[model samples]
Target: MTEVRVGDLAQGFLFRRQAVQLRTELSARGQELSTGRAADLTDRLSGDTARLAALDREVALAATLRRNQAQAANRSAAMQAALGRVQSATEPLATTLRSAAAGGLAGELAAAGSAARGAFEDTVGALNQSTAGRSLFAGAATTGPALAGADAMLDTLRAEIGAETEAAGVAQIVEDWFAPGGGFDSSGYLGADSPASPVPLGGGDQAALDIRADAPALRQVLAASALATLAADAALNLPEDTVRALFDTAAEGLGSAGPQLIGLRADLGAEEARIERAGARIEASAGGARRARASLIEVDGYEAATRMEALSQKLESLYAVTARLSRLTLLETIR
Candidate 1:
């Protein structure tokens, strides 16, 4: 039989109970410390890290898209400006041709020819216009001029006047050069199309720059004028009545081309507006994403500090109780 002293029994029981209580309090303190630390550091960091990473990726994507849009916008703007210049140049030439035809002045006819040549040269220059050192009208071949030595070609046409055979040859050259599948086909302002090449300056299922080197309206007017000039100066011998008829036909053709230019310019304006709105939306979305990511990741320092202080106090109290229990003796209990 194990003999137990009453004093030892009381002291042992108290020590066991004290140890149990201390362990319970310590466990509770440990759990509170772990929870507070996790909330302050791990939990917030984990959530924020993922959210911030995702936001960063989104920001990068938006930036890339914005860059592409900016390039497109710059190209579109350059093309529109070129088209505006061409339209302005063509108007006076068309008006002069009309006036020359109305009045049977040989001088006026000559002046019309000179004006046409100038306008054609300007149009060729516009087609070769560039943006950021890249040829705007070169289609996929943006390294060089869309049409090589285009100025020489216009000069050749200008000098080809005053002979029926020569004018016919020049017209054929122009037609073949700007034909639907010719070398200069991709050099035009618009992309390839079967029936007719559309303008390049509009959005929504059409190109964003509607200027075309081979537009039917423009071609018809130019061809009519060139043929008329040839007829008046060559086989027809500048007969007053023949000159009048040729001039009238040329004038009518020029009028037809004018409306198309106006329409194309309007289309360019609308596309620029659309691009602006899209860019704005992308910027706005990026800002919202950044805010959301920040919310996920950032910890509240004040809250974390408060929780740590409370945990420290509880740990101190547990330590004091544990020390007191460890120092207890059987003699003290009996007394």
Candidate 2:
């Protein structure tokens, strides 16, 4: 039997154990390096990217909504401003009419009637107004003025006035002028008796205006101005006191619509406030979504660095042990 050298046995045992330990360490390191957790993070990052894209789309929509809201607000403001001018024109006419009713000078009364006529013309001009080269009352007809021609509209009004004069006397004509369907229809064109089918702007059948068809203040103001124009013309034939009475009636009609306009303005203001609040909410929501997406995809640099250092240390220890085992020899140990 061959003699078993202690050095040989010790060296064999030590080398085998070292080899086993190194294998175990290498396997652990390989498992650490090949963690499926990284793949999971990558998948999560892809999901984040998808979510971010959706948020971006929402943000873009919000921006568009904001622009639309701003345009609406501007149009509402312009309408209100027109209403203000109507109110200004009516006040003095009302005072003059009241004085005439109390029995005043005929010349002064006729002058007031003339002023009222001019004011009615101005108000009508305001109704057929434009902004940014687009007619506000054209209802989807954006290219040009809502009416075919100013002269044609005046002729239509004059014809209506003539018909009213024939049927019932000047007072009845004045009354008919202030009737509900007095001015251009909802589509901002003459003979728009039906609220639903407003006249198209620029001689087309396309409704371009966005003003509500049933806007009470706008409707009332249009009627009042028409009545005022008729009253002014009738004043030419009547005594000062009778002329004043008609003028007073027309002014009162205009005044009656003033409060309604104020209410509409308030409503528009509230809508503006709501739009602002919605915009802020959208912005906040988008920011939160972006942050959440970043958290899901972003890697922690410090943690990654620490894990790499630990893996390197483990590998180095394994290498040192392997070198020591290789140098072990029975002849060197026996000496």
Best by lDDT: 1
User: Which one wins on TM-score?
Assistant: 1
Could you tell me which 10 consecutive residues in candidate 2 have the lowest summed lDDT?
199-208
Instruction: Quote the RMSD, in angstroms, for model 1.
Output: 10.3
Worst 10 residues of 1 by lDDT: 194-203
Off by over 4 Å in 1: 1-44, 148-151, 155-212, 215-246, 296-335
What's the lDDT for candidate 2? Answer: 0.55
Please give me the total number of clashing residue pairs in predicted model 1: 8
Native-vs-model 1 lDDT?
A: 0.58
**Model 1, residue 218: displacement in angstroms?**
5.1
What's the CA error at residue 126 for candidate 2, in Å?
Answer: 2.6
For candidate 2, lDDT tens digit of each residue in 1-335? 54677996897687668667756654544553555224344365655566656756765654555455455546556655655665676556666556654565766666766666666666566656776665655556555554444344445555655633332255565444334564455223542322223322121212212453236676566555555454556423444445566666666766787788677656656545654555465457557755665565454555545665675676578667767756757676587
lDDT of 1 by residue, 280-334 (tens): 7667877887676556644355654565566567656766765776666767658
